[model samples]
Target: MDNRKEILDELSGLSPRLRDLKAKGDGLTTPEGYFEGLSDQVWSRLKDSPKKETVVRPMRRLWRLPYKSGIAAALVLAAAALIWLNRPRESAAFDLGALTPQEAEQYILNNIEDFDLSMLVASRPEEIADPAGAGRTDTLDSELDQLLDEYLEDVDDATLEQILF
Candidate 1:
């Protein structure tokens, strides 16, 4: 007990305010009705503080531009259409009806190599329906026919069917 008293005397000598607070039991005293008006004190301080200036940023532009390639394509198509509509008309100077049967045959014979035989046959379908099916063909048409005939004469029907079917 004497040792504890000596320690307390040393502490009191160091700080008189601490010794006085110890005598008073507790030094944490508040103003009257502090707890009752706590909410009002907080609100009053909040209202008195300086307000922040709001930033007024402008809205960014939308990416709603029309397609450049699409516009160019439309323009190109319009130009092509206009040119096609206003094109020069072909003259009927060389009438097909003015051609004689012999002259036409001579012209065809002269340019037989140039003409596509399949296209010719397709054009003259009525010529396909010959009397007795006796097809009148020139050297150009009969060349392949003659070769085929010689080939068939050599190969038997069974071999021909195997190759064909």
Candidate 2:
């Protein structure tokens, strides 16, 4: 209780000093008309000073030509690589020399439907035509058909089953 009463007495004592300080108005002063002519003085000073000229040199585009071309080439190569990577490539032609006779025969039999017999006959005009110059002959057609039937007849049941299934 005594501590509180002492604090209150101290604060009351400082109140009159604070009022006196406020009445004295901080005791600082500026030169007469200092602010009124400040802008004009700054403008006059700027006007009286010598102006500085700025010189700008033009950039040489030729200097960067190689670098720009190199970047463009790299971008083109990157695009080409991306296109190559994404495109669907055709399977390479079969290397006939690499296949055994049986393998070649089997491959031919498997893809027999892909061949056009009519086109083959048409291409080999002399082969099927009569040597006597007869326009065309049913005998050659019958012979070719018989040869194909005989060839198929020679194949075993297992080979035929494999080819079919």
Report the number of clashing residue pairs per model. Answer: 0, 0
Give each model a TM-score. Answer: 0.24, 0.25
lDDT of 1 by residue, 9-96 (tens): 9878898677656656665889999899999999999899977777545332222245556667888999999999899853222321
lDDT of 1 at 133: 41
Worst 10 residues of 1 by lDDT: 90-99
Predictions in order: lDDT: 0.58, 0.61
lDDT of 1: 0.58
Clashing residue pairs in candidate 1 (N, C-alpha, C atoms within 3 angstroms): none
